[model samples]
Target chain A: MIIQTEALRREFLVGTRLRRRRVTAVEDVTLTVARGEAVGFLGPNGAGKSTTIKMLTGVLVPTSGRARVCGLDPVRERRELARRIGVVFGQRSQLWWDLPLVESFDLHGAIHRVPAARYRERLDECVELLDMGGFLRTPVRQLSLGQRMRGEVTAALLHSPELLVLDEPTIGLDLTSKERLRSFLSEVNARGDVTLLLTTHDLPDVERLCRRVVVIDQGRVLVDDELAVLRQQFAGHRTLVVELMEPAPPLLGLTGVVDVTVEAQGLRQRLEFAPGATTAAELIAAVARHVELRDVSVFEPSIEDLVRTIYLR
Target chain B: MLAPYPQLMVAGYRRYASYRQATLAGLATNVVFGLLRAAVLAAVVTQRGTVAGYDLPASITYVWLGQGLITVVMLWGDQELARRVRTGDVVIDLGRPWDLQAAMLATDLGRAGHAVALRLLPPAAFGALLFPFRWPERPTTWVLFAASVGLAVVVSFGIRFLLNASAFWLLDVRGVIAVWGVVGGVLSGLVLPLAWFPAWAQAVLRWTPFPALFQSPIDVFTERGDAVGVLATQLVWAVLLLLAGRTVLARGAGRLVVQGG
Candidate 1:
């Protein structure tokens, strides 16, 4: 296993001195990620995702439990583990703000003790793979956000760590930049040399890059399974919207239809049904029998909606 | 194994070298302050012909050297670590493989190097050209003075690191920094030579490691009492302070409460 945790937990002491209290940030979270597996860690805001990453990265020692990254204790052997893993915090820039982008990479290489020839070769590879050649000479403060994030990723990978962990790597990125980063990451995962653990709110990033998904909320894992399996398990309901020719009563009490709501002065009606119990064609046919349909649309559940359902559950 | 320190030093030097406008502005401020302090000290020395073993020339040298070394030793106004702590960016520092204390020291040494060239030399040169400056008589004294200044930088970094690391717990260090700004300037002899203080006060300050920061280097440059002994004291303080800084850092990191999580 590239990463493993048993009964991992962390707590924080917060508030004023007189009324201080301990708040659990992560509790009894057991996880194991094998080498070369790409897993997406999903959660709502303040769900302890970043805290767990911090503990695993040796930034914060856990209040209790055990964590081993690259077969070394994360806190006690942090320096050794640092050599075997790469990390990029999306909101933080590790580059020297005043120096050219390449200088930061050089410093990172030196810090990690990558030999001169190996450093050069890896730099060239990352520069080409991430398409960062044009702005290599520009100072980091002058680069656009997208360009800077690419530089961060390149810096993290210069040492060729065994596992790559990213937190919100695509946050606040434009659509084109987001797609570009996602594709580059997919290529890296496909190489089978690096294990990927990412935490992000962008479900599409997970959909495009991760085969496994772990969903957490309020400091506990709600679901852990393959992305496809999770989707199929929660793919409970599909929405069918139809625009009728004239006003009609709500499409209530229909077979396999769980709920219906009338909209647009009864000209439009949405029917929610279990896909296994009744197919979209069957629902459309049943709605068509009630009234002459002017338009019809079927909506499949998106990953975001599916996760929301899980959270609610 | 030791490769990264030199690389980090170069990075630190380049990092500060890019701030051309800030450097010029800071140099100008140093020179202005040097002139004001020189005028005040020169007046006192001229009236008494010499005070506490310092003649007019030596007192003038003290003022200019203090002004120059203020930036070198970074007596005040450095809250980079504290700010990073408040913003939770120090997590990045902790995550890296290098020892945090050693890395900061190397970077600070690089910054001090830049200050010596741009901030220290220009003002001291200006003082020599424009005032009665006391030049070191021997080449060995010059070397000793250089070593003293370097130790002073390390000692100052040690103290600054401790103050900033408090942010890991305090989460806001402005008040702490404010107190250090005032106390550091006065006790480090930046306001006036420690020799001018009362005998009892001088004896007390001697044990506190503050004089090793500014007084020892300036005293070495001026060929004042016991140059080797003064350098030895500064060296001891440098080592002690650095050790203390490392201990404090480890404790702080143990209970690190990263803000904005």
Candidate 2:
């Protein structure tokens, strides 16, 4: 396993001195990631996702339990583990702000002890892969956010680490930049040389790059399974909205339809149904029989909806 | 293990070198302050002909050297680490493979190097051209003074590192930094030569590392007192302060209450 944790937990002492309380940030986070597996760790804000990543990365020692990254204890053998794993916290930049982007990469290479030739080769590869050649000489403070993030990723990978961990790598990125980064990450993962562990609120990033998904909330894992399995398990409901030719009563008593809402002065009606129990075509046909449909639209369950369902469960 | 530190130092050097405006502005401020301080100290020395074994030229040298070394030792206004701690960016520092204390020291040495060239040299040159400056008579005094300044950087870094590490618990170190700004200036003899202080006050300040930071280097440059003994005291303080800094940093990291969650 490239990463493993058994009963991992961390707590923080908070509040004023007279009324301090221990708040559990992460509790019993038993998880394992095999080499070359791309997993997306998902959670809402303040869901202990960052806290877990911190412990795993050796930034914060766990209050209890065990964590091993690259077969070394994170706290005891932090420097060794740092050499074997790459990390990019999206909210922070490891690059030197005053220097050119390439200089930061060079410094990172030196810090990780990547030999000169390998460092040059890897730098070239990352520069090409991330398409960062144009602004390689630009100081980090001058680059756009997207460009700086690209530089950060390149710096992290210059050492060719075994596992790559990113927290919200695509946060606040424009649509085009987000898509480009996701595609580049997918290409990296497809090589099967680097294990990927990412935490992001952008579900499409997970959908495109991760085969496995782990959702946690309230300091506990709510679901851990393949992305496809997760969707099937929690995302059972699909909505079908139909615009009828005239006002009609709410479409009820339909097979597999769990709920219905009438809107637009009864001209539009939304029918929520279990896709496994009834196919969209069957439901659409049944709805067509009841009314003369002017327009029809079927909405697939999004990862956001699936996670929301998991949280509610 | 040792290879990266030199490169980190170079990185640190380049990081500061890029800020041309800030360097120029700081040099200007140093020169301006050096003139004001030289005027005050020269008056005292000219009236008494010499005070506490310092002639007019020696006292003027003290003022300019203190101005230059103030930036080199970086007695105050360095809140980089504390700010990083408050922002929780120190996690990046902790996550790296290098020892945090050593890395900071190496980087600071680079910054001191830059200060020596831009901040230290120009003011001393200005003092020599404009005032009666005391030039070190012995070549060995020059070497010893260099050693003293370097040790002073290390010692100052140790103190600053401890001050910054407090942010791990305090979350905001502005008040701490404010207090240090006043205390460091006076205690380190940046305000006036330690020799000018009464015998008892000098005795007490000698026991602290503050004099090793500012006073020892100036004393060495002026070839005042026993140069070897002054350098030895500065060396002792450097070792002790660095050890204390390392211990405090490790303990702080152990309980590291990272701010901003």
Identify the leading candidate in terms of DockQ: 1
| lDDT tens digits, residue span B1-261, model 2 | 237899889888888899999999999999988888898888888898889889999999999989999889999888998899889898899889998889889899999999999999999999988999899999899899999999999999989998998887788899999999988999999998888899999999989999989999999999889999988998898899889888888877888766665
- Model 1 CAPRI quality: medium
Model 1: CA > 4 A from native: A238-273, A277-299
User: For chain B alone, what TM-score does every candidate structure achieve against the true structure?
Assistant: 0.97, 0.97
**On residues B1-261, what C-alpha lDDT tens digit does candidate 1 reach at each position?**
239999899888889999999999999999998888888888888998989899988998999988888889998888999999889998899889999899999999999999999999999999999998899998899899999999899889988988998887788999999999988888988898898899999989989889988999999999989999998898898889888888888988898888886
- Per-residue error (Å), model 2, residue B13: 1.4
lDDT of 2 by residue, A206-258 (tens): 99999999989878888899998877788968999999999999989999999
Model 2, stretches more than 4 Å misplaced? A239-273, A278-299
Docking class of 2: medium
Q: State the lDDT of candidate 1 residue by residue for A1-313, as single tens digits.
A: 9899998999998889999999999987889999999999999998899999999998899999999999999999888988889999999989999999998998899899998888999899888977999999999999999999999998889899999999999989999899989998899889999999999999999999999999988888889999988877888678899999999989898889998988999999989888778888988888888899999999877998888988999
lDDT of 1 at B90: 89
Weakest ten-residue segment in model 1 chain A by summed lDDT: A228-237
- Which candidate number would show the highest TM-score if scored against the true structure? 2
Model 2, TM vs. native: 0.92
